[model samples]
Target chain A: MAEKHINARGLQCPGPIVQIFKEAQNCAAGDILCVEVTDQGFKKDIAAWCKKTKNELLSLEEEGGVIKARIKKG
Target chain B: MSENKKTIIVFSGDLDKAMASFIIANGAAAMGNEVSMFFTFWGLNILRKPEKIRTRKSFMEAMFGWMMPRGAGKLGLSKMNFGGIGAIMMKSIMKQKKVNTIQELIESARALGVKMIACTMSMDVMGFKEEELIDGLEFAGVATYLGEADEANVNLFI
Candidate 1:
């Protein structure tokens, strides 16, 4: 499967999630989407989004106020 | 009636409230939920067109139309607006934070297939013509909103 990166860093609230959703629409099943965000709410939001969307949260990490996530499309 | 359906009644006209409605709608829609927003009362102002649309109306209707802010750009915040300066400051902060503006949020919600319904009763009371509001909106009444809400698991009044 192919992997795509979404630079959602600096976006706030739903901005990062919406960007990931928009990008995910173009990806095939099993494709991985990597996203980075600076929004403090993203950690909880991303987990909830993955659960609701049935996507696999491969990895999630935070450093220096930037949170990164890898999601495998379901 | 799908389990993954949401309905929001946008009752207030404040910019902050409008943004909140759109943010939730967009978030739910991104998570693969169907979302519907009903605009009524002062919330109808959020859908108004920015440009002046010439339409014949009664004196009170004309006055109401003249007094209300036109479109998303003109809406003021619900609190600490400071005679509109707060809205300007908020917009600047959102820009700095790379947050989407209400205009962008509305566009994103539309693109995500979120249903936007404008209340006909409110339109009549407010003297707003169909052409006076932004495009891509469904004109309906409370019954329609109720019908949508009945099928939705989450119903919020903003």
Candidate 2:
């Protein structure tokens, strides 16, 4: 289970990613964060952010219209 | 590859253009890139305070301030301004689309540590007071902008 959950659905490009950046800061090392977004553009953006911030992207899944990303803080 | 460095010169005070600048800046900063934005000419209007603040200035300077948009919220559209109503419609549409507003984008850029610089020459020419602009800004000349742009991996003028 994710230690923190972020509901960023319906947000446009960059908004969802910004929210993830802010929330990820509060997560301790080894804590997992789950982000829910509606924009497909976030797929690439989240991957880049995770790599830049040194976080681990465990999984990214899409269901219906929602995209869920699970990231482990590093 | 080496770390990315992005620098932008904001020369337009239009709402859409300002929005674009912030969006790019925030994205670059989020990706661990060093981002710098230099506001000059009409672009300085984007940094003006929202409320009307009376500052002692020459008549010409006061007129310039009065005529320009107060802040990001008051900037007109570059094209199809439609007497300023177009800007209002655009703001509404952005809200409906769940896009970050220009003001929100500016805040995000600041939070992400994007360097905000005001062109000293432009400020003098436009008769803008230091107090009239937003806080957390570095004042410099064109040389300063060039210095940063020279080393930036991505340089843009908007």
Candidate 3:
């Protein structure tokens, strides 16, 4: 499966999620999306979004101020 | 699985409020939720056409239409506006922050298939004809908004 990297840094609420959602739409069912966001609120938002969209969250971690998440599309 | 529905009543015409409502609507729609935004009262200004359209109006209607800000681009902030300067500053900050403007958000929401409904009663009160507003909007009354809200899991009044 192909993998995509999304840099959603410097965006506020809904920006990061919107970017991820838009990118995910162009990907195949089994593709992987690695998203990096600077919005602190995105930590919880991403989990909730992944749950609602039925995407599998591979890992979520924070390095410095950026939050990184890997999600496999379901 | 059944799709979730969201209904938002956009009652405020302030730039910040409009942005908030659109942001929520766009986010919900992107998450595969069916989202509907009902524009009523002052909120109808968000859907107004920037360019003046030739429409017959009474003296009072013409005055009201003239006084109200036309379209999304002319909207002002609800607080600390300093007579529109705050709105200009806010737009600059939004640009620097790389955040989408209200126009872009509305376009994105439309692209995401979010339903936008303008309140017929408000249009009547405001003397706004269909041609006076932006295109791609469904005109309806409160009953229609209530019906949409009834099926929605989340209902918000902004």
Best by DockQ: 1
Instruction: Give each model's clash number.
Output: 0, 0, 0
What TM-score is obtained for chain B in each of the predicted models? 0.98, 0.96, 0.97
Docking class of 3: medium
Ranking by DockQ: 1, 2, 3
lDDT of each: 0.94, 0.90, 0.92
How many angstroms is residue B49 displaced in model 2 relative to the true structure, after the best TM-score fit? 0.6
- If both were scored by lDDT, which would come out higher, candidate 1 or candidate 2? 1
Instruction: At residue B80, give the lDDT of candidate 2.
Output: 84
On residues B4-84, what C-alpha lDDT tens digit does candidate 3 reach at each position?
999999999999999999999989987879999999999999999999998999998999899998999999999988999
How is the predicted docking of candidate 1 categorized under the CAPRI scheme?
high
As a TM-score, model 2 comes out at 0.91
Model 2: which docking level applies? medium
Better of 2 and 3 by DockQ: 2
Report the lDDT tens digits of candidate 1 across residue range B1-158. Answer: 77799999999999999999999999999988999999999999999999999998899998999998899899999999999999999999888878799999999999999999999999999899999999999999989999999999999999
Total clashing pairs in model 3:
0
Candidate 1: regions farther than 4 A off = none
